[model samples]
Target: MRNLVRYCLILSVFIMFSCGENTDKKSGENTVEEVQTETEIQKSEKNVILFFGNSLTAGMGLETSEAFPALIQNRLDSLNYNYEVINAGLSGETTASGKNRINWVLNQDVDVFVLELGANDGLRGIPLEETRKNLQDIINSVKEKNPDTKIVLAGMQIPPNMGEAYTTEFKNIFPELAEKNNIALIPFLLEGVAGDPKLNQQDGIHPTAEGYEIVADNVWSVLGDVVEKE
Candidate 1:
């Protein structure tokens, strides 16, 4: 009877161990499934933003990944926002060139567009009307392709040396286009960095690394509102 009782106790211990093992296996599977589900949600929520502009947007003096777009991506990551930024900036590209390439660039999955052209055009003394039309067409095309995508027009200001009339028209183009399209507008892309030697490169046209920070701030101020709405 003593031996039989001992045998029964041993069997009970074996059964409890088996039950615990099964429970642990089930819990492990559940944990894996939960992790996979969360990963899928993150992948699906990723937002794609495109930056279309000239050398300024291309990060002429800095590395591609260190540009303002990349900085903005970092900022978004720090804030826990799911986003992917594409830099479509072409060095020396004018408004006309941007217009020509806008269609090709829009072929990608774009959730938001940061239009920062016209600086080259302004420097080249391109007709303000033509620049405006090109920008207008680009915005319209993007809207047509992706009606839900948001457009953020980055305004530019020609140097005072460009003459009052030309500068006035160049600066006004962004606001007019944004207002007409009912899109977000960044009044000035350079803001605190423009004309500041410390922020600009030696050429006095492109921005330095510090200048990119100011540019990011200028963009963020307006983009924050749009992000909040989203």
Candidate 2:
């Protein structure tokens, strides 16, 4: 009877230990799942800053990291701003092409929309009216998708090669749209780096990597005011 009682007590302890181990494993699994859920929520909560433009925004002829948009991302990250910078730049992308592509780009949520087209259009000497209309349409599309999306128009200028009147009109498109739409504007996307040979690449159009740092500054000057950490 003593041996039987001792055996029963050991069996009870073994069952209790097994049950406790299983409970601990289940608890660990629950904690892991909770952590994963929190991480996913954090990812989904990050706001997007879309830089839509042509070669300049695409960082043509340089590493993607050297582009102004990426530099802007670095600044945002350093400032603890929870924003994702999407470089929707395409080489040789004109205002009309950008308008056509805007819908696809807007599939994702955008908090700040930096419109950086018209440079290519101006360079190509596309009709000022067409450029203006395409830009307006693009802005309208963005507004329609999300009225609250902050639009920052990047003003561009081309050399007198396009003729003085055309150059002036092309440059005017940006500010006019900004005023009409009541959105933010970057007076000149290539303020200090435009004519400087050192800042530009061999093509004399796109900025060099170092030049992009200044370009990033130009963007941030206006963008900083629009993007507030929420």
TM-score for each of the candidates: 0.81, 0.85
lDDT of 1 by residue, 96-132 (tens): 8888988899888788889999898888888889999
User: Which candidate leads in lDDT?
Assistant: 2
The C-alpha RMSD in Å for every predicted model, in order, reads 5.9, 3.7
Model 1 misplaced regions, further than 4 Å? 1-45
- What would you estimate as the lDDT of candidate 1? 0.89
lDDT of model 1 at position 199 = 89
Candidate-wise lDDT, in order: 0.89, 0.93
User: Residue 123 deviation, candidate 1, in Å?
Assistant: 0.3
Best by TM-score: 2
Candidate 2's C-alpha lDDT?
Answer: 0.93
